[model samples]
Target: MPFRAQPLRLVPVLAALLCTAPAAAQMDHAPARCTAPAGLPAPMASWRNPLALKAGADRKAAARAILTPGRTVTLALLPTPKVAYPVRPAKPGDSVSHGGLASFTVKEAGTWRVALGSGAWVDVISDGQAATSIAHGHGPDCTGIRKMVDYDLKPGRYTLQIAANGEDSLTLLVTRLP
Candidate 1:
């Protein structure tokens, strides 16, 4: 006779497992901004990310919290990014005024979102890749952040550039537990 699984005994186990994701894919629980200083680029054609810290959490204790809509976390986006910059400013949006940038540290590897809020275009640079970008005349927020793009980030900083077209007035809030 084949062994049968017990559903009743597996409810808690399933819940626990479902409650946590992998390290690299766990950024889904990290904060919005980094643990470094925040910044705002001068409206130009190109730009570089700043924040140079890791996810808001360290390994072992707690996982880094990912930025989710309606759940804001405190963090930073250093204008002095880890990568080299040609001094190229970011693509200013249409209505970005009183704007700036914010970064989030990586506690562990996990999926996360740098969802750009109200602006012409928000550019997200992770691990030196311009992965997620919100185009012009588009909404400020961008979801469906891909894996390896915003998750399982190395113990380092990630940049989220939120700006508008004319005068950057976009507000970036960094949210994280702890």
Candidate 2:
């Protein structure tokens, strides 16, 4: 009789555990959502409306899409093999991923920030050499920006290479830091 009562008492506990199992599993797999703050900083405000552009398969083709400073552009990329990067990406992109190139002219020498919405590799090239990145970080919360890389650049014609991106498109912004 005591054994029968013990099993009955455990019935409610077993039911509770079984019922909560699915909810716990769902919580573990749920994607995190970023809540927007009251406002974005000035540097990130232009990212709200990105200009659409197509990336070039090579440096010459990349001349068609010009990257403007302080403006955000969403680039449609090509397969990694199609892009002929002037300077190979320091960190090569996935062979199965996408990449492309675009041109930007730096009018003044300063620290320039390249912001992206994905974890793609960025290479700023000029005179057959790649500019070294000075700093790396993430964008402001809720802005949808995944990474930022800074480079010290002089006034010249440069190529902005986007590589190893998992998606077919990417959002990018090149801005000079004050």
Candidate 3:
């Protein structure tokens, strides 16, 4: 009689291979938006995001968090932003106030580093409060340097409002030290 194949023996091998897959390769998740506001744009055409910095956890942490560093956050601003802060005197192609909004969630509470490419301005809003870094002359990356902002944040949801100085594209990156 010819040798018969043992189909049952292969089940264990297949199971072992499936279980050993990396966590990242097992699932595909979407990266949180970094250029657009969280839910809806607050249903306001001229709403400027608020900026605030606090020492510890607060009421804002109650909301769910949603951003992951695995994906890249890149976006283009509208021809004319609904809200513009006009940080300086308006120049041609410079609205100052026109900016895009992005929302993210903080999985762990810690000091987070937020870096913006092309010297874009950012307004951090939490619990309806806002705060910004004050610079009299120009942004950290205004002169072709990357701008970085650091803040102590609690685990919660956050809205990042950003506007390009003059360019049409902006890149926002967020990370925390291991």
Candidate 4:
């Protein structure tokens, strides 16, 4: 008789494997713990769509909106070579393919809020570590979802890793919390 693989025994092994996967990374948001940074009328940065393409399919056009201070930038967030960083390799069951990069300098050493107009998954990467508190995926405007991440930041430069779940056009804005 040939030996057979037991289906029930595989359940536990599969469950354990999923535990180590990056699923949590997809929904990592901790806004409740966020406190407003100290400073009245903190600096505000705005970027409008510079490409004027009104679409997120063009990689070069989308990259133009990479978060510059006191300026309006525009760009689509698609998976293309023009993206700021190399497209991350996809894993099984992963659907996100669009991403963009932006950098900002914090002048105050307090809690700050990074808000995005459309609902896109955002990662506040600093010192090579991802932020644990991100408040996003809400609102009732275009696309019906907005992303906001409040973070405690010091005086330094930081990068914002943003990605889109679909081929949607939108704008991104960054500002200091009250």
Candidate 5:
């Protein structure tokens, strides 16, 4: 008689295979833990230690803090209604939101980046007009930055307006692209 296949004998073999499947799958698809980049870019590295300042309610108050390129500042914002943007934000926040104004002088004309730790509207204003934005994107993963906006700026004083932020404080950085 020909040898017959035995179902009972295969049960133990199937059970062993099933038990190891999950472990093998996990080894293949396990997510990697998030860690800072091996070496952070200059602008991103500045976020590690941020200077604290109060956001200005209006043009007058904005003079208190001078935003510098290549550095990060944490601004304490005010109620949206209290902020008087030199030029209206392209995306205006509701009254319940928070906002503020700060000023920065660009000694060199170039493409400058404005990075924010929250989803806030940023408008760079010079001579009472809004500078056109060149680019918009999210910051690097694992960094607290949520948004980044770029503008082509000329050497001069500009108003950095923060609007429509959900929180009363925001971390901001201005860095020039080489």
Candidate 6:
């Protein structure tokens, strides 16, 4: 028999399942429990996304944290062969296809908020984890989102590039701090 049987029968089952101690009635509740993702590193243990961003259809997913320097023997590598879909396999430090995502090597791993100059959608790829599940800023007069990353950085060179449609109208300014 199909599970989509009587709708009335299902009501009671759902009600019972949802009927946990009402928080108002309970008076006291502990804390909510959660599992962190495997890839996140230390610097980002406290990572949180203010805006809910979804991993792009072609991009990978990230935990709240990321990789760290010195502590990292290996890293989450991204295979950025083509900007198109059905991405081909890649290695660590692959460049973004559309030049939309900027490739940077952070020292540690954690959730980092990206600051964009304008309200446009900016792609960010860190240490090869899927580009962070964030769309570019889209508020009034928002150019692009830009900010520092959570990965503890080492003394190394990184790349920041924007996607181009063979035409250029905007520019991205990138700087690193000590």
User: Best-fitting candidate, measured by lDDT?
Assistant: 2
**Cα lDDT of all candidates, in order?**
0.36, 0.89, 0.47, 0.51, 0.87, 0.33
How does residue 38 of candidate 5 score in lDDT? Answer: 41
- lDDT string for model 4 (1-178, tens) is 3345577778899998899666675556433332443222223333323333232223344344345543434435555343443233232113445566656677777766655555566655567566566444343223212555677777886666666435444455556666
lDDT (10s digit) by residue, model 3, range 1-178 = 3345566677799878878765556455434335544331121111123222111112232122223432334545544344333232122235442345556777887766665555666656676666443332222312222566666777877766555446555555555534
The TM-score values for the models, in the order shown, are 0.32, 0.79, 0.47, 0.49, 0.78, 0.25
Residue 174 Cα positional deviation in candidate 1, in Å, after optimal superposition: 6.0
Model 1 quality (TM-score) = 0.32
| Candidate 4 minimal-lDDT segment of 10 residues | 85-94
Stretches of candidate 6 above 4 Å error? 1-101, 126-129, 134-161, 164-178
Per-residue lDDT, model 6, residue 151, is 28
The predictions' CA RMSDs to the true structure, in order, are: 18.4, 5.6, 17.4, 12.4, 6.6, 15.2
For model 5, the superposed segments whose C-alpha errors exceed 4 Å read: 1-39
lDDT of 6: 0.33
lDDT of 1 by residue, 1-178 (tens): 3345577678899888777757536687554554543342222101122222222212111124233322333233222232132122375422223223444565654444333334323445465565442222221112211111122234466555443323322223332212
Query: Candidates sorted by lDDT, descending order?
Result: 2, 5, 4, 3, 1, 6
How many residue pairs clash (N, CA or C atoms closer than 3 angstroms) in each of the candidate models, in the order given? 66, 0, 14, 11, 0, 37
Q: Candidate 3, residue 169: CA error in Å? A: 1.4
In candidate 4 the C-alpha lDDT for residue 51 amounts to 33
Residue 6, model 2: Cα distance from true site in angstroms: 32
Comparing 1 and 2 by lDDT, which wins?
2
Residue 142, candidate 5: Cα error in Å is 0.3
Better of 1 and 3 by TM-score: 3
**Could you give the candidate ranking by TM-score, starting with the highest?**
2, 5, 4, 3, 1, 6
Q: Report the C-alpha lDDT of model 6 over 27-108, residue by residue, as the tens digit.
A: 5653323353333323322232222222222323223222222221111222234333222223222344222333345543
